[model samples]
Target: MIVIDPASAVPPFEQLRRQLIDDVSTGTLAPGTRLPTVRRLAEDLGLAPGTVARAYRELESAGIIETRGRNGTFVAPQGDAALREAQRAAASFVDQVRTLRIDPEQALALVHAALRSAPTAP
Candidate 1:
């Protein structure tokens, strides 16, 4: 379940996006699982439709989900070569971290730091 903390420093849309990404990556949300419509999710989370739409758009752009016109959005199948390679790299990283006995929180922090320092695409 996606929880939005009004008190959180992070924006609601980012919270939703991160939660959905984690769910998809961890297999908590299986491939082909249908996601709630933007309107419905916004209502359920007490957020604006535009916020949910923005999250959805970002996820779709990242190849994490797909929208079927009139049919609704579902988890994207793991067919993209780039996505598959990324998943493999992530799994390998996790294994290496585990072998080093690194705490998950610290590992995630390292990832966040790296992402922040990385250059953006043009």
Candidate 2:
């Protein structure tokens, strides 16, 4: 369902990246969803393969998707209980911030301050 507007101010790769991220985050693309291969997606979108590859690389770097050699790319599974809990907490925080109409910069500032005040482990 991803659309790339040829006349958009945003770069095509970035458009793809944001859409895929949004899909994964919102569960539109559930975990284990197999993404189209870079070449296939590029062909479908009428973009260069490198463009799709770059988007895939960025998503993989962000832990949103994983590439398994020969098996293709798929949405990354929630790996551990603690990590899943943390993700849920983060989603809750985002919802709360949205409800409060907090700007991203202000919300990030709050997070930074909280992080600075938190005690570190040995």
Candidate 3:
């Protein structure tokens, strides 16, 4: 269920990367689930093989997935660690917002602003 938004400001590879992370984090792609080969997924998504490869490479680096040589790629058994951290942070934010009597929409807007202003890792 990967989707590429043509109108998005994010690069296609990044979009794919994030979607895969979300899938893995949410159990949409369960631990040990085999992933489609880079070539097959690129063909399915109408993307260059290199794009898919890059996404897979980053995923592997982040310990989200692993490549088993000829056996292909599979989700990591521990799921996404970064996603777990994000969930914890989100829960804390929700609690803080509730305590402060902020509207949910306002809290979401604040989060969006923070994300937009976030600096990239060096």
Error of 1 at 27 (Å): 1.0
- The order of the candidates by lDDT, greatest first, is 3, 1, 2
Please, what is the whole-model Cα lDDT of each candidate in the order they appear? Answer: 0.86, 0.84, 0.87
What digit string (tens of lDDT, one per residue) describes model 3 on residues 22-59? 88877889989999999999999999999999999988
For candidate 1, lDDT tens digit of each residue in 14-118?
889878877887888888999999999999999999999999998887788999999999989885424654677699899999999999999999999999998
Give residue 21's error in model 2 in angstroms.
Answer: 0.5
Candidate 1 whole-model C-alpha lDDT, 0 to 1: 0.86
Clashing pairs in 3: none
RMSD (Å) of each candidate, 1 decimal: 9.9, 11.3, 8.2
Off by over 4 Å in 2: 79-122
Candidate 2 colliding pairs:
none
TM-score of each: 0.67, 0.65, 0.69
Q: In terms of TM-score, which candidate is strongest?
A: 3
